[model samples]
Target: MKIAFVSYEYPPDNAIGGIATYVQQAAHLLAQRGHTVEVFTASPTRTGCEAFPGLKVHRIQPLNRTSFPQEILATFAQRHHVVNFDVIEGPDCGAEGREIRQQFPDLPFVLKLHTPSYMLAAISHIPMTRLAQARFFLGSLRRGKWPQSSPAYHYRADPEYQHALHADVLSGPSQAILHQVQTDWQLNPANFINVPLPYIPPAISLDIPLDTSTQRVTFIGRLEIRKGILDLMRAIPLVLQQYPAAKFRFVGPAWPSPQANLNMQEYLSQKLRRYAASLEFVGAVPLDRIPEYLAQTDICVFPSIWENFPLVCLESMAAGRGVVGSHAGGMAEMLDGGNAGLLIPPKQPKPLAEALLQLLQDPDRRQQLGGIARERVLTEYSLENIGQRQEASYQAAITRHQLKFTNSPSIHA
Candidate 1:
């Protein structure tokens, strides 16, 4: 099958987060499986096509600072005229594929679920801009309700919501996120499917001995409220009180805290000043260096308030590090319901600290969990498994598109 992927983010150029990683790995996997995979992505400085053995990347540059998604639609149309792609997929975050779907209604378009902007804003505690707030206030007065009321009105206006509503099919990495979006958007259950992300395991051997001389607890990802970083900072003092020798490492870029009116790093430093000697803030390392950090870690903790399917957790699990993730989202399923890793409640410092202490004290249990985690990733979330699932989803989308257009009187006319 000839497949086309439309994303604003792709690796080595505009890569930002998990979406880039997912696209890179998935595209390569499909290409390796004899499918003609073409990736339509954005680049700030360069615009051209790069051809690999089985994959082609069409890097698009915006014209006169125009909308990126609109540029993507134009590029996709030019390529489709010649290549005639079998299926085209893109993320729902920016609704990058919405314009393409509108222009090419007969072509199957898969809206891959990433955390949408509205959800991210709420999760990160980001307040609306003054203009938006004023608009909301006026809208509330017209509806005769408080500014805080009418969430549905806000959702309806979101481009991501509208795009999801119109996609040929929707696919997500976790059922947790899929269910939430389906309910919020009032979507058909049959239109959405769950397909876990593909992960390429670290090239290093899994049997490498863990460095257990000093108990090291690592928290990766952006330092913000959504990541439950504040609660982790609160829990650090408790863990230090019991085990003073244990060390903590935060590996990510620092974000400002609106609530504290200061950068998160500064806030955390002032709050946990006494435990400064034990903490290390390794800010924003490149993607290649993560395995080296995980190699030294005895325990990995991700206490996010909500997540779809975090790749960091999977990376930690692949490295044979015992993971402690929050139960508020998909981590519970990723950890096999606490059998492979410990699950704790999100935003609760006490529970997070307790779980850390448990793993710190027990070397045997940590090793056991780590071993199980490695096996789980190898078997369940492998490239072969995920590639097959992705292909199946595309086929389903094509069939759905065909049926919808086939029964339409306008198409017949």
Candidate 2:
């Protein structure tokens, strides 16, 4: 099958977060399986097609600095006229594929679910400032809609949500995120499907021997309220009180907190000042350096308020490090209901501290959990296993597209 992926984020260039990682891994895996995979991605500086063995990347530059999506649509249309892709897939985060779907209504367009902007706003507890609330109320009045009636007014306004509503097929990496979007959008159960993301284990061995005596806790992700970074910082003090020798490392770019009027690093510095020597803030390292940090880690903690499927957890598990993940989102499932790693409630510093302390005290338990997590990643989240599932999902989407548009004009024409 000839597959085309449209994503704003793609690795080694416009890589931002999990979406880039997912697209790169999935596209490469599909290509390796004998599928002609073409990726349309953004490039701030360069623009052209880069051909790999089985994959082709079309790096698109924004036209007049105004129409990135329009440029994508035009380029895709020209390519489709020649290559005639079997399926086109893209993330539901920014509706990057929305224009493509509009152009080729009969083509199988899969809206892969990532956390939408509205959901991110909610997760971060973005306060409705007085001016913002006033604008919303005024806008509702102008549109002749009651503000109170539309609790999800933001969802309705979001292009990502609208794209999900009309896509040929919707697929997500986690049941938790799928369920949330299904309920929120009032989507038909048959239209939504769960497909886990693919993660290729690092080439170098992640089997570093666990240092039991000293606890090296590492958190890898943007430091934000949504990621429960504040909760993790609070828990650090508690953990340090019990086990003073334990060291905490935060490896990621720092995000500013609107609620606190300070960046996370600043907040951490001010709050956890007493334990300054114990904490390490390694901000914004390259993708290749992550495995190095993971190798040095003993216990990895991800206490996010909510997440889709986090790649960080998968990396930690793959490195044979015991992970303490929050139960508020897909981490619970990723941890296999606490079998592979420790699970804790989100937004609660007490439980997080307790969980961290539990692993810190018991070296055998950490080793045991890490071994189980490694095995789980090898078996479940592997490239081979996830690639097969992705293929099946794409085939299913094509079938569904054909059935739905049986009487419609052929997109090939």
Candidate 3:
């Protein structure tokens, strides 16, 4: 099958988040299985074509003010005469799906739902000051118009909801994400598929021995309140109350705005000054070093307020570390309802700290949970298994597309 992936973030050029990693991994795995894979992406700085053994990447430079979906369609139209694809898969959280379906009416297009703006707003609990709230409400009042100048334009004028309405197939990394999108969009459940993220564990030995006596807790994600960074910071002091030797590490890049990194650094310096000796902020570690870091740690904590199957939880599990994740979002499904690892409520420090303390004080329980976590990844969330599942979804989408063509009712008005 000739498959084309339409994502702005592909490897070697831009791998910003979990979606890029998933797309790259899926493309490679499918190529390894003797399928032809092509990626159509946008690169502001550079534009050209690159090739691998079984895969090819085409990068385009769009005009500054032009919409991304329109640019993608124009690029595809110019290239489709030479190379045809059986299926084109792109993220649904944008206007791309609606545009592509409109431009190429007969083309088979599948839109995978990652995190939509509406879903984010629905799950978000971060408080805002009156000034900020006033700004957001005023921006939203514009309605259907994407004012590039407004700070909240992305959240307010998000076109993913419209895209989903026209998508041939709606897929998500987990059932939780799928259900939430379906309920919110009022879509047919039969149109959705539960496709778990594909994970490839690091090749290096993760069997390094660790100090079991001292509790080493790690958190990896954007340093934002929505990621439960504030909650994690608050919980650290509580954990330290019981185990003074407990070490905490906060990893990953900053988010929300350009100055977020500076702001987070300031917060750490001022608020967490007393615990500076025990806390370390290793900002934005490379993806390759993540497994090595997790291998040395005893437990991983992801207390995100909202998520659609985060990559860190699965990576931590694959690294043979017990995870203390939030009870909300897809964490419950990932952790198997506290069976694989400990689960805690989001935006609260008390229960989160308690859960961390419980796992930290008991090495036997941590070891047991870590073992189960690793086994779950191996048995279910592996790259090989997920690749096969994705392939099945593509096939099923093709079948559905053909059936739609054949079963269309006559429309003679």
Candidate 4:
């Protein structure tokens, strides 16, 4: 199959996010499977072309604009160099999907919903603000709190791309995402499929052996309130009351926004100073060094309020550490029926801290849960396994579009 993979981020840029990693893996894996893949992505670091595996990465560098991504894709439109494709797939779309359809009427286009543009528009600031406003005015909307509205009809009804895309396939990192997309867009269940974010078990080795000796609980992700950093901070007061030695270690990139990072840092730094000895912020560590940090830890405490299937949860399990995540979002699905790990209520510090304390004080239980999580990840979430599933989805979308086109008399040259 000849696939034109388009994304706003790709490797080396590290883009340092869940979606970037997933796109890189999917494109590379599909390329390895004999697909002639040409990738079109934004080069934040530098503008040019590069190659990885069987794919050629074309970097679309935009002129000075806060929202360079939407600007570049929307402006390029029919002018995009890579026009003809066996399938025109635009994931995480807004301008890309909308504009591609506007200019390329003959091309059969498909869109994948990562998350609703509205939810992002809500929490997102500055640069993303305009894109959000554009999305709302275009007919794409929000449904409720947890589930994002369908991105299907939203794209189809769009003035630019509405009539260009004849078929759509929806995917997110979890069942929760798929269910919401189906309900909001009024899309058939058959039009939606679940393809989880791919997990590449790091070629990491334990530099420091698991000592089975500490009651420290480690949380990996942005140190923001939504990530349950605040909840965990509050839980520390309670955790110390039960187990005096209980400590929480956080390792992730400081928030990407400087102002936001400063605000969060001041709060977390102040809390750390107040505790003086319990709260530890290891700051942002590279993805490769993650296993080394997990090596000394007994449990991973992911108290996030909402996550689109956290990649850190998989990383923790892959490192043979027991995990405790929020009952919300895709964490429950990652835990494999709740038997693989513990799932606690969101925003509630009492249960979250208790779950952490329980795992911390007991070495045997930690070992048990850790073992189960490792086995489950190897069985279900390995990059090799996830890559194949995503490939199948990509092919499925192509097949569905092909069938629809071949049967329709309107599909003409």
Best by lDDT: 1
Rank order by TM-score, top first?
Answer: 1, 2, 3, 4
> Which structure is stronger by TM-score: 2 or 3?
2
| Deviation in Å, model 4, residue 51 alpha carbon | 1.8
Candidate 2: tens digits of C-alpha lDDT, residues 302-411: 99999899999998888889899999879999999999999999989999999999999998999999888888989998777888888888888898778765664322
Candidate of highest TM-score: 1
TM-score attained by model 1: 0.91
Decide which is better by TM-score, 1 or 4.
1
TM-score of each: 0.91, 0.91, 0.87, 0.80
Q: Which ten residues in a row have the lowest lDDT in candidate 3?
A: 147-156
Write one digit per residue (lDDT tens) for candidate 4, span 55-80.
87777665532355455454344324
The backbone clash count of each candidate, in order, is 0, 0, 0, 0
lDDT (0 to 1) per candidate: 0.86, 0.85, 0.77, 0.67
- Candidate 2 has its poorest 10 consecutive residues by lDDT at 404-413
Clashing pairs for model 1 are: none
* Model 1 regions lying over 4 Å from their true place: 63-66, 126-153, 205-207, 259-261, 408-413
* Model 4, C-alpha of 234: deviation from truth (Å): 1.5
- TM-score of model 4 vs. true structure: 0.80
Measured on C-alpha atoms, candidate 4 has an lDDT of 0.67
Summed over model 4, clashes come to: 0
